[model samples]
Target: MSDTMTVKEAARLWNLTERRVVGLCREGKITGAKKQGRSWQIPATAKKPLDQRIKSGAYKKQAERLPLPIGISDYRLASSQYYYIDKTMMIKDFIDERPQVSLFTRPRRFGKTLNMDMLRTFFERSEEDTSIYFKDKKIWSCGERYREYQGKYPVIFITFKDIKFDSWEMSFEAIRNIFAKEAIRHSELRNSDKCDEIDKKAYERLLSGQANEIELSNALLDLSRMLHKHYDIAPIIIIDEYDIPIQQGYMKHYYDKIILFMRNLFSGGLKDNRHVSYGFLTGILRVAKESIFSGLNNLTIHSVLDNKYSSYFGFTCDEVKEMAEYYGVANKYDELCAWYDGYRFGKTEIFNPWSVINYFHNECEPRAFWQSTGSNDIISEIIAQADNEIYDRLTSLVNGKSFTTYIDTGVIYPQIKSNPSTIYSFLLVAGYLKVLKTTPSFNGDYMCEVALPNKEIAFVYHKEILQQLNQIISPSIAVAIQEAIFSGNHAKLKDLIQGLLMQSVSYYDSVGENFYHGFMLGLCALLSGFFVSSNRESGNGRYDIQLKPKNKKLPGILIELKAEKHGTEESLKKLSQKALQQIIDGCYDVEMFAEGVEMIYRYGVAFSGKKVEVMADSVSSKETIRLSKSDYRSF
Candidate 1:
C-alpha cells in the first residue's frame, strides 16, 4: 500500500526523540527505512526496538507473586506451593471416552510428569484422600460423572524419568529401587489377604529391594495384580518417561540388554494384562513398535501431531494470555512470544511452558531457559557424525529455512546412523525442531516440513555447531597447522585452516567472524599439548585466540579472524594485513611476552566465502620479520 512515515512521525509513534529514531533507522533496527532529503522514510508497520534497560524504583513493599515452580513434579505441591496454570482438566479428557492404553509422547519438561502425578492424585485410592486438592480445580465442577471417579481407583504410577545409569547392572538396580518404592506405596499389598503365599515372598523381596533381575522384570505386571487383588478392581497404570532406559541404552551402548528387559516390563504390564484396567505412558520419542511395543495391541499414541491432547502438553495462546494478564506483564506478551512461541502440538500453536514460568520468575526478563537445562549431546553428536546429506540439511535449518522429510515418529535409534531422516525425526521429537506442516503418507506416517521453532533454540544450535566443529576438526590437522605456524610455513597453515572451513561449509555457512572464531578455536583445541584460550583479556583488547606452547620451547601463535562481507581483491588483501596490524597495535601477545615466551607468530586470516587471504609474520619484542611471504597472498 506504499504506507510510509517520516522521521518525525516515526519518533512520535515509537515514543523517542527524532534523533534517536533516525539513529535506529541507520542501525537497521527499524527496517524498511529509506533516506529522503535529510529525513528517513520508514515503513508504517515498523516497530520500535524493545528497551532492555532494567527499571529502577524506590524501595517499597510489593505483593509477592507465588513462586514459579521450577522442577517440582508433584502437581499437588506445585499447585499449592507455587503459581500454577491449571492443567487438571486433562483428567476430564482422560475419563471421557478413555483409551485402553494411551501413550502421550512429548519433549521433556512439557508437564508430562506433573500431569501423570495429577492423574495419580485424582485416581489413586489413597488413605490421605486427595480429593481436597482438586476441590477448586476445573474437573470438580463437572459434577458426578467426573467427580464420582475421583479417588475411586487403585492407581499404579511410576516414573522412570531419571533412570540413567552407567551399567546395565546399575540400571537394573535403578529399576529395582523404583519397584521397591512402589511396593512401599502399596505396602497394603504385602499384607493383602487375597494375595498368594509366593506373591507375599516376592512382594517382601521387592520391598526389601533385593529382588532378582527376573523378579524386577516381572515387578510392574505383578504389582498390578496385587493392587487388583487388594482393591478387588483392576489398577490404572501410569508409566512416565518410559523411554529413559532405552534412551540411556542407546547412549551408553547397552541397547540390546535394556531393550530386552524393557520389552518384557512394558509388555507384561500393558499387553493383554487382565489386571490393568488401562495404561498411560509418556515418553519423548515413541520407540518403534517392532523393537519395544512388539506384539502389544490396543495402544493409542498421541504425539505432537495428534489434536486430542495438544493443549495438555503445552500452554495454549489463551492460557498464555490469561497468565500474562494475571502476572501484570500483559504488555510484554509479544516479547514472550518471540522467545517461546511457535512450538506446535497437533493443531494447537504452543508456547514452551518452562520458559514462560522462568520468565515470570525472573521478573519478566526473557532468557534462554530451556536451552540451558540439558547437555543436548544428542543434537551435537548427530551433527558431528552427520553425512554430507545430513550436513546440508542442517545448514538449511540453521539458515532459517524449512525442509520436508518423511517423519516416522517411532524413531529407532540405531537407524539414525544410516537414515539421515531419522535424525530429523529425533530432533523434531526432542524439541530441537518444529513441524511446520504435515501431509498424510500411505504408510500412515507424515511427510513433515520442519524448521527451528524459535530464537532461543536457534541460538543453542549455533553454539552446538561451533562446538561440533571444534570436535570434528582433526587433531592431526591441528598438529600439522602448529608445525606450519612455528616453522615459518604460513602458506601451509593457511591452507589447512581454509580446508577445514570449506569442509564445515557443507554443514554450516561460514557467515562471519562468529563462525570463523569457532573454526580457529576448534583447530587450536586439538593441540591440547599447548595452552589454548579464546577471547581472553590481554594487552589492550580481547584476542581471537592465543596458543602458548606447554613445552615453553615453541613460539606462541596469536590468531585474529575477520569476515569478508564486501571487498575488492585489493580491499580483501588490506583486510587481512589490517587484522595483522590490529593484533600488534592491540598488543594481543602481552601475556605470552610476560611469561617469557621469546617468540610469537601473529596470523591474521580473512574469509570471503571460499576465497580467503592470509597475512602472517613471526615477530619478537625486538625484531619483526614478515616471515617469507612468497607463498602467502600479498595485500
Candidate 2:
C-alpha cells in the first residue's frame, strides 16, 4: 500500500491531531515524513511516534498524543524538540522594562528555571546567535525593538540551588565549586590575547577552586567586570533559586552563616556594579530579613501577589485549554481543573504545569506528582506551630473551604518562629496555598482569602494535619487510650484523655472547643482498623464519629463531644447528658442499625481544658439500656 498523504490525511491515518503530526514531522521524530509548501507530506504506512505515552499503554490502545515537557530546562531543546507552551513573550516584557535587578519569587516546580533559561538564552551574548531560538516563538512578533536586544550583551548566569548541604562549611564549599565551574566555562577569558599574565593568574586561581571566601564572594561581580572589559558592554546576570540555600539553612540550623555569605555575594554583584546592565533572581522565599538584597537600591520584587509577571511561571487557563485540545483530551478539562487548577496568580487563574504534564503523559490519570518532589516539611513544621484558631482555619481549608487573613509576603526565618501565621506567607509563596481574593483592610494591610489550590495541595494540608496530631499526641499514649476504650475501662480512658488534653493546652498551645473536637477525632483514629468515619452524613444528621467493629460480635460505637463553658460538676453533668440526648435525637446510631450490628456503645464526653465528664450507655435488643455506676462520671 504505497500511498502518499497530506498532513491532515496522515493525522487521520496515524490517529493523531494534524498539529501534533506537524510537530513530529518538523522535529524529524516521525520517519519518512517531509514538509513541503505550508504543510507536511507523510507515508500512509507511518506508525505513531513513541513517547512517555507508550509506558501508559496508549499505543496499544491507539489514538493518543501527549504534550508533556518533563523537567527540561534548556530553552532551545524544549521549544525545538518538545511541545513547549509559548512563554517566550515574557522575554519581550522583561527586555522592555529592563529592571536593574528583578526578583521573581515563585513556588517549586512552577517552570521558574525553564523561564529563566529562556530569558538568558534570548539575551546573553555567549558568542552564539541565539536569536534563532526565538525566531518562531511569540517574541518574534514583538517587532524590531525587542529583536535587536537578542544576544547583544555578555551574560553571567548561575544557580545557588546546589547550596543545599548539612554543614555551613560544606555549603560554602559547594557554592565555591559552582563559581569554579562557571570559571572553567569562561576559561576562554583567560585566553584573550589582550589579557595580561597577572590578571589571567587571578582567573586561574578561581578555575582551580583555590579562591577563598572573600574572593568567591566577589566572584560574580568580578566576572561581570571581566565580561564588560572584553565585550565593551555590561552583562545580564541571571540567578535561579537564589534562596534554596537560605531555606535549607533555616531548616538545617546554619541560617546565620549562609545568610551572611549570600548577602555579601548578592551585595557585591548587584550594588553599584557598573558592569551589570540588568539582573534577574528567582527563588521560593524573598529572604527579606537577611538583607540579601539590601544594598541593591534598584531592586524590584514581584511576588505571588504581584500583578505583573504572574502568568509567566505557571500555565494560564488559555494555555492549558489549548494544550488539552491539542492533545485530544478536551473532554478532560473539568477533571483537569479539579485536580490541578485553582491557583490565582495576579488576575489570571493558573494550573500546575508539572502536574498537568504528568497527567497528560500518564493517560490523563490524576495523581499527586508535585508534592512528592519535595517533603514540604518546612511549611508543615510551621503549621504544627499553629494555635487553635489557625488550626481550625487549616482544617477548614483541607475540607475544601477558604479563609481570609492578613498576609505578609516578606516572610523571614525569624518571623516564622515569632509569629506562626507567617507560615501563611511562606505557604502562599511556596504554592501550598493560593489566594482567592484580596482587599485592603483598614489597618493598611491586604486581607486575603486563601484556599488549597486543588486536590493535590489539599493532600498536603491533610498530611500536615496528621503530622501535627502525631507531633502533639504520642503514639504509645494513643495505643493505651485505644485499649482503654476497647476494654470499657472508663477510668483509664478519662485519665488518658485528661492527660492528653492538658498536654495539648500547655505544650501544644491548643485551646477552645475546636481543639477538643480535633483531639476527639485523633482519639477515634484507634478504630481505623475496624470501621471508622468522622463527621459524615448518616441517617437523619451528621455524626461526630461512627465506629463499627470488624468483629460482628462486638458492639458498634458512636461518640459525641461537647465543649463545656465552665468546669463545675453540675455544668459538666448537664452538658454530658445533653450531648447523649442530642446524639439519640439525631439518630446517630441509625447507621449502625442499618449495618446489622446487634449491640451499640454510645458515649457523650464533656470537655473544658484538662477537665472532662464522661457518660456512656449500651443499646441492646432495640432498647436504650442505662449505664452501670462504673460507666457514668461527672467530675
Candidate 3:
C-alpha cells in the first residue's frame, strides 16, 4: 500500500518469481520505487495491473482502426487481432506445469515462429512504449491470471532463419552478428562488469575465425549466464526454426558436419545450463533427439500429427469465416474452403493462412491464389525421375483421381527424385490438390482421391509440363505434326510417324504397324487449348480421336485410320464406310452442327509400306472423294 513495496509483495502482485522482479529492476525494463536501504517499492499507479489499464474503450478503438500493414516485415500489424484459437492451451500449460526443454515440429508457414514470438512478448518485461502494443489485444482478454504473468522474465529469443548461406563461414557470421546486436540492446548485459570479458573475448574469437563449435557454444552460454547473474534472473530461451540448419545442410549435402556442430552447440547451452528458466524450440523437421538434443533427456516433442496443439499453428475454420466476413468476401467463403480448408490435424481443420491473406490482398476472383508462392521445385524433381507407372499416375491425376497422401516434414528434400505419384502426393499436401473422395484402396489404406484444387495450380501444371516437353521435342517436329493434321497430309504424317517410332522407346514396337494411329493420339495430347481424349465412348463403340478445339466453330475433328491389310482400294472403301458409321454412331447432326458444316469432315486414311492413301467421305450427302498424291500434297 505504501510507496515502497518489498520484492515479495511485487512477486505476489504480479505472480512472478522474486528473482524476475528483482531482475526487472536491475535491467531497467520496469520501474517503481526504492526503499531507504535494502528493499524495492511500487508506485500506486503501477499497482492497478497492466491489463486493467488496457481495458478502456479508447484502446479497443485504436486497436481496431489501425491500418493494415503491408509486406512481410509488417506481419505483426495484420496479425495482431486475429485471435489464433487456444489449441495450444496445453502448450501454455506445459510451460507452466514444469520447466523443461520442448520441441515442436510443423511444416513451413505453420505459425511456429509466431507462437514463439508471442511467448517472448508475454514473459519479457517491456518499457512503456513497447507495452502499449498489447493494449486491448486478444492475449489480454484471457483475464487477470495471464495478465499477472506478463513482463516478468528475461527472454533470450533466437531465430535460425537468417543463418542460411551458401557457405559455413557466412552462416556462422550471421549468427554471430545477431547475437552481438542482441547483446548490445540489453542494458544490463552491455553495462555489467563482465561485459568487456564476454564481448571482447567472444567476439574476437568469432571475428578471428578461430572459434570452434565448443568455443562458440560456450561463449553463448557464458553470455546468457552473465545476463542472468547481473540481473538476478534465469533466462527463458526461445529457439525458432531450429531445423533450418538441417534442411540447408541436407540440400547442400553437409548434413553430418552441420549436425555435429548444431548438436554440440545446442547441448552446451540448453542441456545443463543452470541459468536457463525454460526453453521452447520449433522446426520443420524433428531429427532424432539422440542425434540433435543428445543428453537433453527432459525434452518433449509436439508434432503436426499429434492432436495436442494443431490449432495453435494454423488458421482454423472459424477464423477463416471471420476473415471472410471482415474482408467483405463472406459470399466466397465456401469457394475458399473448397480450395484451401481441407487439411485436418487432430480435431482442428486448418486453411493455409498465407494463401488466405494473399486472396484478401489481391481480391482474386475465386481461384488458387497460393500457387503463385513459388515453383514446385520438388515436383519437377519427381517428374524428372518418373517411370511409366509414375507417368500413368500423373495422367490419372490430370484426368481425375481419388487418392491423397500426407507428407511428413522431413520427407521432402531439395534434390528429391521426381515420380508421378510422388509429385501428385506433394501437390496434394502443399494445397495444389484437394480431396475428391474417401475411398478405400485395395491395400486397405483409406485414400483421399485428389485433383487440382483450383485453376491456379492447374494452369501452372499445364504450363510447366508443356514447357518441359517443348524443350525436349524439336519445334520443327511439333510444327510438322500440326501441319500434317490440319492440312490432312497423310503421307507426310505417315513418314513423320515412322520417324517418331524410330526415336521412341521399344515399348511402342509391338504397335509399329499402327504407328500413325498412335502418333495421332500423341499429337492430340500435345496440342494446347484442345480437350483431347482417345477411345472415348461414342454410341456403341469408341471414338479413336476426339478433338474439341478451344475456340468454338474451329472444327472438332473426329478421325479413323486403317492399314493396307485388305487392298488399298478396299481399305479406302472400308474407311469410308467406317467414317459414315462413326458420324451416325456419334450422333453427329448433319444439319445445324456448325456454321461451315452440315456434318464434320470425317477422314479415313489407309497406309501401305510408306504409300499412304486417303479417302474422304461426306455423311450428309453420302459423297465419296479421292485425291492423288500431287493434289493431296498441293492441298
Candidate 4:
C-alpha cells in the first residue's frame, strides 16, 4: 500500500486482478508512476476507497430514509447498502455445488437485474468508498468469512437491456460506447500504450458518431485484455438481461446475423480470454448455453424451478414485512401481501418489489402500479397473434383458474404461428402468473403448474386485456356501455349490444356465453367499490347479473338477457321468470330490503337479429304480477 508499490502489490492489497488495477489506472480512477523500464508504480494516495468516495452526506441521508428500492438503477452496490436481502447464503451454496456458467431465469421485473448487481458488488474489488456500504450491513455480521471476501476479485459487469438496434451495426456501436465509458472510469489505462491508442480512437469515432457493434466489442475486449495483463488476474463477468438482444433479434428477424456477431464477440472476450475467472448471466428466457457460451464447460444453470438460490433474486416475505415496517406502512402489510406476495421463487415466498415500492410511494392504495413501468407492447403483439385456444385460456384466467402450466419461452408467440401457450407462458414469466404446484415424476423431472398469484395480478391481467381491446374496438365502446348501464337506457344498451355482436362475432365465438357475461361485467369492473356477480350459483340456479352499488341506499339492479332468435316476447317472458325465480330462490324480500334502497326493477331483455326488446315487471306485494314496458329500440 506504499506510494511506490508495484501494480502487482496494489492488486494483492486491494484483492483485485492486475487487469482491474490497470483498468482503474486507465480510467484515471487510480494513479501510477512509470520507471525507465516501462513498468508503472502504484501510489497509495491514487487509490481512493469506494466506500469513502461514494458515501457522501447526500447519499447517507438518502439511504437512511429511502422508502423502498423500486426501479433501482445502481443495484450492483447501492442495493446492498440500503436494503440487501440475505440471498448470499443461498448463492454461496449454489456456487459451492457447481462451477459452470449459471443462468437464472425469471419473469421480468422480478429483480433479476438486482441480483446480478448484488453479485457484482459482492465479488468485485472495491475502493475505500465501498466500505461505507458494507459497514453495519448483514453480510459483515456473517463473520470472518464474509469480511475476508470483501474487496475481492476484478468484476466486469454488463446489462444487455439497453442494447437496441435496427441492424447489427447499430448494436455494435452501442456496445462499444458502453465499453468506452467503463474504460474511461478506470485509472490504470490512462498511461498505458494500449489505453492511449484505444482512447484516442474511441473518442474520435464517438465524436464522429461512428462505430459498429463488432468493432466496439473488439475494442472493449482488447482494452479488457490489456487491463488483465497489467493486473495479472482474471475478471469475473456478470451479465444482466442477457436475453434482451435475442428477444429483439427474434422479433426483427435479425437473429441469425446478430446471434453470429454477438456469439463471436462475447465469446472472444468472455469464453476465449485466458484471464476470465467465472461468469453469471440472467434473463427472462434461458437461451441455451451452447448457443452463447460455447466453450465454457463449468456452467451452472439456476432456473426458476431450481431450489437453490431461488430467494436470491426476489423479495422474501420477511423482507416484505421489514420493508413495510421501515416505511411505516406496517398496518397495510396484510392487504399488501394479499395482493402482491404469493410468488414462490423457491422455498421463499416473495412479493413483487416493483409493485410494493410503488404502493408505498403512492400511499399504499392498490392499483395497477406495475403497468406504469412499460406499455407491455410484447403482450399486445402476442394477443394480436393469439389463436382461439389462447383466447379461451385468457377467458379462463379472467374467470379464475386454479392452475396453469408454464409454456416454453420459445413457443411464446412463435413467429410462424400464434401460440396461446406462448401468451400464457409470457404472462407466467412476466410476473403476471406464479407457480402454484410442483409435482414430481418418476423420471426425475418435475412439472410446475402456475396460476394468477393474487387478486391484484388477476385484476391487472383483465384490465390490461380490456385496455388492449379498447384499442382494437371502438375507444368509445366501453364508455358507451357504462353510460347505458348507469342511466338504464334500454335503447342505447340495445344499440351497443347489436353493434358489439356485429363487430365482435369472432370473440363471442371464442368465449361462448361468458363473452357476453364478461362484457357486461366489464362495465361495472372498472368502477371502484362496486360489487358485480355473473352466473352466481344459488339454491335453484345461477343469477345472470347482480349489480350491487357501492352505497347500500342505491338500488341494486338485477337483470337478465337472452338470445331471442325466436322472438322478443318469448325471450322476455323467459327472462322475467328467471329473474323472479332468482329472488325467490335467494329469499330476497323486496319490501324488507334496506330502507331508502330503491325498489328492485326486474328487466328481461331479448335480442333477435337487428332488433332488441325490453320487458320490465314489478313484483306485487299480494302475489300479483304487474308487467310494463320501459322502452324498446332496434338497431
Candidate 5:
C-alpha cells in the first residue's frame, strides 16, 4: 500500500462518499491529508474520522436535522423542521366529507393540538406562502381540488389546553385571553369597511380583552362574521382541547358556570351560524350531557370507536415501522410495539404517538412516557371511586386480562361516581384501556372487550392505580409494610397490616377474604423489583399471591390470606397458621423454585374485622432450613 492515497481510495476504504472525504480532508479531520490540485490525498493507514457533526440544535445547520419533535405542537415548525409524520391526508378526508361541524374526541397528547394547528396552517391566509408546508405532504398529492383550499380562508384558532384553573374567575379570564388572541390575529377586520360598525366595536373590545361575559360568549360568532365580511369568505373555526375547561370545572366544583358559558359560546358559533364555513373541535371527551352542543343537529362527532379519521390522531403501524427504520432501531420494533402499540382507533391499530416519539428520542429505551406527560387526575378519580368489583376488574386488566363491557363514548364527568359502570367508558376514552373487540350496542354505545394497552400502560396502571390506595392507606405505612415484608420482620409487618386495616377499611369492607386479598394485592403490587401475581396455579392449587423478583438474587415471596367472620384472638392465630400450612401444602413455591430463585419468604395473614394475625417462614432451595427471627436481615 502507498504512504498516501487519493480521495476516491480513501472514500472507498472509509466507506464515505468522495465529497464527504474531500470535505473531511479540507476541514483537517483526515490526518496528514493534503490537497493535490483539486483532489485530496490521505494517509493509507488513516482511520475514518470521528463524526463531530452536531445532532442537537446547537447550530443552525444541525438544527435542521434534529431528533423527533417531543413536545412540539406548532404545525409549521414541526412539519418543516422535525421528523414529522404526514397527517395531511386527514385534510383530504375532511374535504371529501365536508361536514359543516366536526368534533374529534381523543385522549390528551394524541396529537390533537398539532393536527388543529396543521388545519390552521393549511387554511388560514398569510402573506408568506404557507403552501410550502404541505406541498410535499400527503394532502398535496390528492389533487388540485384539495390544494386549492390552501391559504384560502380566514381562521379563528384557539386552544383551551392550557385553560386549567381552580376557579371560574381564573378560567374565564384564560378563555377570554384565548379569544383575544384570535381577535388580534384578525386585526385587519377591526378597520374593514365591509364589517358592520357594531361588529367592529365588538372586535375591538375582544382584541382589547375588555369584552364582557355576553360579548365574550359571542366572541367566536362575532369574529367569524367580521372575517367573512372582510375576506368575502367565511372563516374556519378550530378549537383544540375544547373539553379541558369543562373537565377542570367538573373537578373544581364550578361545573354549572363553565357549562353555561361553553354552551352559549359553542351554540352561538357552531349552531346555525352562517358566518362559519366549517367548525373543528378536538377534546378528550364528547361531554354530551353538558348541553354545550345543544340542538346542534349539524354537529358530527368522531370518537376513538369511530372508523373515520381514526389513524390521524395516533401513529399507525406502518408509520411506526417507517419511523423505527428511519431512526435505525428497526430491530426494536417488536419491543416498541409491545410497549407503545396496541391502541385501536376504529379498526386501525395505533401506537401512542407521544410515547413512540419519546421512545426514539431517548434512544429506543421503552418507558411510560405517555403517563408522565400530563396529570392523571381523571384516572386518580376513577381509582378513588372504584368499588370492589371495579378494583378486581382493574386488577385483572393489569394481569393481562380483558373484559367485555358497554362503552358509552359520550360519557360525562358526572357519571363517574353516579354510574360506576361508566368507569370502563372513562378508561377507554381517556387512553387507559384499549378495545380488543367491539359490538355496537342497542343505544348509541358499544359492547367492547378492553384491556390495558401495552407494557407502558401496565406500568402506569400498577403505579397510579395502586398508588391512589395510599390515600386511604398512608404512604409511610405502606412503605413500612413493604419494607417489613422484604426484611422478614413479621412483627412489624403484622402491626402495619393491622394498623392499615383499622385506619383504612370500613366495617362493611372487612367481610370476606376477597377484600383482604385485594387490599394485600394493592400493597404487594407496589413492590418495585417484583412481578406480582395473584391466584395463579403453582403446583396443585392456585396461590393467593406471589412476588417473583426480576433479579434472581432477590428472595421471592408467597402470601396466603384468610378472613374470618367474628373470631377470637386464639381462633385468628389458628386461622393464620392454617393459611401458612396451605401455602406449603399447595406447593406454591414450585413456580419460584423453577424460576431458579434460591430463597423464598412464605407468609400467612388472617383478618377478623379490624383485628389481624400474621405468620411467616423462609425456605431455601439449597437446604430446607428455617429463617429464625434472629437470623433476619434486610435483603
Candidate 6:
C-alpha cells in the first residue's frame, strides 16, 4: 500500500465524494491525514471512516458508555439503557395533584410521549414487576405514601402521534389498528371468566379489527370495563399526542369527522366512566373548543401557560447544566442555553430535550435541532392567512421583539382561519414562541408577551414563519426592493415599491400609513445580517424603521414613512422630503452611532393612492452634512 494518497484517491477508494473526503481529513476523522496546500494527503493504509449518517434503530443497543436517547420514547428502554434524567418525580406530582383527568398540552418532541410512557411504566400492572424501573428514581425516595401506586393499576396506553392521514377513511383505519394493537396487548380479558359475554365479544371485535365506527367509539369504555372486571381494578388511560390526527384533519379537510370520532372516543372512555381509574392525555393544544371534551368537566388541563407539572415535560435549567457536566461539555452550557433554553412552559424556563440531547450527541455544535422534528403545517397555514397586522407582529417577533397578545390556550383548528389572533396561541403551544410575561385572562385564556424562544427558534421562525411573506410579496420583488434599499437607489426603490403597491394592495389598503408600514416591515424582515426594528425609540424619538447591521462594516439604515389620503406625485415628492427631514431632526441616527456604525443611510418614503415617492441620503460618522428645514418648505 502507498504511504500517502491524495483526497481524490481516498474518495475513489472509499466510495465517497471528494469533498466529503476532504471534510473527513479536515475534521481529523481520517487517520494520518495531513493538509498539503489547499488539498489533503491521507495514508493509503488507513481504513475508511464510518459514515456519520445514522440509520433508524442504529442506536438501540446499549453501548459500554450510554448514548443520549435521541429518539427513544419507550420508558423502559430509555430509562434503563440510556443516560436518562430521572423524571419519575412526575409520578409523585401526578399523585399529589390527583386530577381525575389530566391533559398536558405541550409542543411536539418536548418529551410528551416519554413522560406519558413513564406514567404507564410507573402505574401499569404487569406480571414482570415493572416497579424495578421506578425503585431507584425520585418517586421511590418519596416514601410509601407515593410509592404504593407503582405498578398497581391496569393501564390503557396508546399514542396517536403517528396517526397522520389524508382522508377520514385512512385515518379511521389507522386508529382502528391502534386500538386493535392495544386490545391484543390486553388479550387476557378475552378469555377471563370475570368478563361478561358482551364485553368479551366487544373486545374480540376490536382485537379482530372488525369494529365499526360506533363500536370503536365504545371500545375504550368497553375495554376499561372488562379490565376492571377481570383484574377487579379500574385502568388508567394514557393518550399521547392526542391532537396530531385532529391537526392533520384540519390540514387535510377532514376536520369534522376526526373531531366527531375523537369526541366520541373520549366521551366513552373518560366522561363519567367509573371503569377508568384516572385519565391522562398530552398534545400540543387543548382543543376543548372543538367540544371533544364538552361534558368531561372533570378534565384538568395543564397547558404551556399553567404552572402545574411545568418542569416535567422539558429539561429545566439545572437539568441541562447537569447534563452538560455529565457529558464533559460543561463549558458549553452558555452556548446550549442561548440556542435551546428559552422555552417557557408555564413560568418555568425549559430547554428543548430533543435538541439538547442531539446537541451533545453531535459533539456540542448548536443548530435548529427541534425545527425538523415535526410538521410546520400550522405555521404555514397561519402565515398563509395572515393579515397586515399579523404580518407586522410576526416581523417584530423575528427581529427580537415581543408584544402582548391574548392567548387562547384551548386554541381550536378552525380558529386558525376564523380568528387570526389565535396565531400566537398556536405558536406558543406548538413551541415556536416563548412567553416573556403572562397574566391570566378570562376563562382560562392568557394575556402574554411572547417572542421567538431561542436562537434555534429565531432561526426557525425566520426561516419558517417570516419566509411565508414571500406568498404575499414574491421573492423576486422582495429581493429587488432589498437591493434598492441597500444600494442607495431612491428611484429604483420607489419604482419597485410603487409597483408592488399597485399590484398587491387593495384601493382600501393603499390609504393608510399602517398598511404600508406593515408591508415594508414584512419585506425588511427577510433581510440577512441586519437587526431590523420598527416604531422603536432611536435618536430622540421613535423611528419608523431601523436596520442596524449585525456586522458593523455594513451601513446602518433608518426609514421614515408618510402617507396621505389623496395627493399628486408632486405633493408626494414634497412629503417624502419632509419625512426624510424628520429622520435628521429627530436624530434617528443616534442609536446606530452609539453602536459604532460608521455609515448610515436614511430613506423617506411616501404613499398616496398607488403613487409613491422616495428620498434618501447617506450619513457618515466620518463627516457631517446639515440639511435646512427649507428642504421640506415647498410641501
**In terms of TM-score, which candidate is strongest?**
1
Relative to the true structure, candidate 4 reaches a TM of 0.65
In order, the Cα lDDT scores of the candidates are 0.77, 0.75, 0.56, 0.59, 0.83, 0.82
User: Cα deviation in Å at residue 482, candidate 1?
Assistant: 18
Model 6 lDDT tens row, 62-151: 245678898999999998998999888788888887899999998888898999889998898889988888878888989999978988
lDDT, candidate 1, at 571: 73
Ranking by TM-score, best first? 1, 5, 6, 2, 4, 3
* Tens-digit per-residue lDDT, 1-635, candidate 1: 66998888877675455656776788888878888887789988988787642331211223776766888888889878887778888888888978889989998778898899988889888788789889888889988899888888898888887788878888989888988898898888877899998879879999999998788888878888888888899999999999888878878888899999988888888889999988999999888564577777788899988888899887888888888777666655655665688899888999988988887776664555785665465665566567767766765665467899888898877777766568888888888789999998999999999998875565556555534645446556667876776676878877886676576553334355655665555445555557665554577766777888776667888988887765556776778887887887788887787777878888887877655778887778555553343544452
Model 1 per-residue lDDT at 26: 86
Segments of candidate 1 deviating more than 4 angstroms: 1-62, 469-503, 506-566, 569-635
Looking at model 5, report the run of 10 residues with the lowest lDDT sum.
53-62
Residue pairs with clashing backbones, model 3? 5-41, 381-418, 382-418, 382-419, 383-418, 402-449, 403-449
> Per-residue alpha-carbon lDDT of model 3 for 8-126, expressed as tens digits?
78765765446556756665656554544776665645552232111111112223533322234222343464433333244346545655787877655656666787677667866
- Give the 10-residue window scoring lowest on summed lDDT in candidate 3: 52-61
User: What are the runs in model 5 whose C-alpha is more than 4 Å off?
Assistant: 1-65, 470-474, 481-635
What ranking emerges by lDDT with the best candidate at the front?
5, 6, 1, 2, 4, 3
Superposed model 3: Cα runs more than 4 Å off? 1-99, 129-131, 194-200, 203-213, 372-635
**lDDT (10s digit) by residue, model 2, range 310-355:** 8898899889889887886665665577678988877778899999
What is the Å distance of residue 350 in model 6 from its true position?
Answer: 0.7
Q: How many residue-pair clashes does candidate 4 contain?
A: 43
The whole-model C-alpha lDDT of candidate 1 against the native structure comes to: 0.77
Give model 5's TM-score versus the native structure.
0.71
What digit string (tens of lDDT, one per residue) describes model 4 on residues 352-465?
777877766655545556655654656776777656566656656554455545445333224424344566556766677777877765554445677667656655665566
